[model samples]
Target: MKKFVALWLAATCSLALFSQGKPTTKPMYLSYGPTDGKNIIKFNLLGAAIRNYAFYGERMLSRKVSLILGCNFMPRGGVPYLENFTDDETLKTLEVGTFSFTPELRFYLASGYGGGFYIGPYYRFERFSLYQLSTTFDADEEEHTIDLDGSLKTHSGGIVLGCQWLVGSRKNIVLDWSILGIHGGISSGNFNGLTQETISPQDQEEIKEDIEDALDIPIIKSEVTVNDHSAHVKIKGPWAFIRGSFSIGYRF
Candidate 1:
């Protein structure tokens, strides 16, 4: 009996020790910290260099998905890179202001939600305000100058192929590279030129031709009308744009 009791006690003690050594699984709750950041705010450095102000906010949705919202504004200023858009010297005098808003849904190929190679579908709305000064001829071949003011608006949607990486020891610095993005949509706007004196029919036609000649883009079309003292130009066309950016962000 004594021997049996001793063996039983030893077995019970062993079982208890084994239970203590084995780890019990506990439920884990995800919290925001250095390892896991849920939100990010980014600035477009390249855009700023071109006199464009752009910003973006991103939120992680899942292990492989996220959402982003971006905004950009360019104050009324001289057209940047005029040589690439047109060879017309009149366009060199053109000034414009631009504003755009974009929303995107991203799917990351790797495990990380906001960092890795990503492809996203995005929608954008953009508007441009145009201003220019031009000299035209009247019926008698006299010089007349006019100031034109107008706006153009476009809506487009496309896919964005990009990659993002987290660097630094704490992984708080982010680099986002957008490889290629293309979008197409319709655009329409009107420009009005006001002059102090009444406009003649011949001068109106000349003004119309001059304005149309300045827009060298093949996809765009314009219709012009003239009243007593003002000329109106209606612009309509299929508009397309490409997006590319290398943006820096802070994850928090």
Candidate 2:
């Protein structure tokens, strides 16, 4: 009886070991998480075409949520596409540079864990610098040229809607398109102009009037002060902007 019991116990131990080493035939369902691509870096192709260097970075917080940051810089040069919109002669000699930063939170509306349509709220802080700008205004029946320089800064918040797609064999390539974005906020700036020749009292007043007249828009207000050789402009305005971009990127 003792020998039989010993053999049975050994058999039971061997069977348990074999069962523990067996592989399951159950199907696998992969879920997107930290193990998959969870971060993306992108470049704005549309902005680059217009001389604006723009870049964006995104990180997934969950299956349907992400956080993003975008930055853009345009080198000092003539205003882009200004001639296409207006024939204003005064703007022909103006040059400007721009920089902006935006932060956003995106919520995706799709079935899968990857690319899809998304709507996000974003906040933007932007700045513009005007340099070496020259404009002529007639004072005392004489054409006088004033060299002007200034900077404008604004802060705004808005919502953007867009879609993204993951491409390539491993879905590591990302294409992002921002369909539409709208923002509105306040802007303030100051510009100063200097003339080579001395300004008469009458000419100073006339210069102030001319500056004010040019800025007489329903949505914005400005104040002008003129002295013997220089003129100053203070600007306060409500500003609005529309945002759009097409970008390509890689996921990691």
Candidate 3:
């Protein structure tokens, strides 16, 4: 009887010690700390006076790295005449598209406050098309058809620098701004459609004679050879963004 009682007491004491040591953690309630890195994705809708619809995609590469791609539709206006031409004709309306890719490095000055700066190199592609319309002569009463066989396209490459700030505790909202320098070439095919028309054969003969005389000048053929075709056009300017965005993020 004594042996059985001792065995029972030992079992009960072991059970009490195990039960009182620590409570098992419930799956329902859990807690975490800040400073944990998160994966961030944000989409932005953008617009400007020159551009209509613009969209952007940003993904976090790391805690301090990101990749961005953006595109925008620009409606080109104003008919600025080229300096080589004597005519005052200007380029009319046309659709322009711009695409950019940038890999950025972000520096966080403060952890919780969400203040940072970003700078990176970028590649930009821009395309523009010119359409020819009817031309009106200064003295002629009737208009003539202008044949524009195709359009001009330009490709540019440059670098971008920018900064950003976050508002609120959750870091759900952010403000961003940027500027870029773009440089490339503008390529336009030959302009062979410009021709003079006269009602009288005598006027045609006179114009032909003038052209022949102009060609007889002693200027070097290579120097006088006018080729408006360019493989690249230099585009350098400032690109800025003032935007507010919300982001959904995940932490591992």
User: Candidates' lDDT values, in order?
Assistant: 0.83, 0.85, 0.41
Q: Which stretches of candidate 3 lie over 4 Å from their true place?
A: 1-46, 75-115, 133-141, 147-149, 180-182, 185-252
Which segments of candidate 1 are over 4 A away from where they belong?
Answer: 1-36, 83-87, 133-135, 139-141, 215-221
Would you list the clashing residue pairs of candidate 3? 79-91, 182-235, 184-233, 185-232, 185-233, 186-232, 186-233
What's the lDDT for residue 32 in model 2? 32
**What's the lDDT for residue 34 in model 3?**
46
Candidate order by TM-score, decreasing, is 2, 1, 3
lDDT per residue, candidate 1, 70-159, as tens digits?
A: 999999999888888778766677898999999999999974657789999999999999898554656446767677888999989889
**For residues 1-252, what per-residue lDDT tens digits would candidate 2 score against the true structure?**
999999999999999999999885421222232455678899999999889999999988877889999999999999889899888887888899999999999988983343799999999999999986665656667888887799999999999999999887667788999999999888999899888787878777777787788889998988889888888888999889999999999887
Candidate 3: how large is its RMSD? 12.2
State the lDDT of candidate 3 residue by residue for 135-188, as single tens digits: 222216664333333343444455555556554455545566553333443332
What ranking emerges by lDDT with the best candidate at the front?
Answer: 2, 1, 3
Top model by lDDT, which number?
2
Point out the higher-scoring one by TM-score: 2 or 3: 2
What value of lDDT does candidate 2 attain over all alpha carbons? 0.85
Question: Backbone clashes per model, in order?
Answer: 0, 0, 7
Clashing pairs in 1: none
Off by over 4 Å in 2: 1-36, 112-114, 137-142
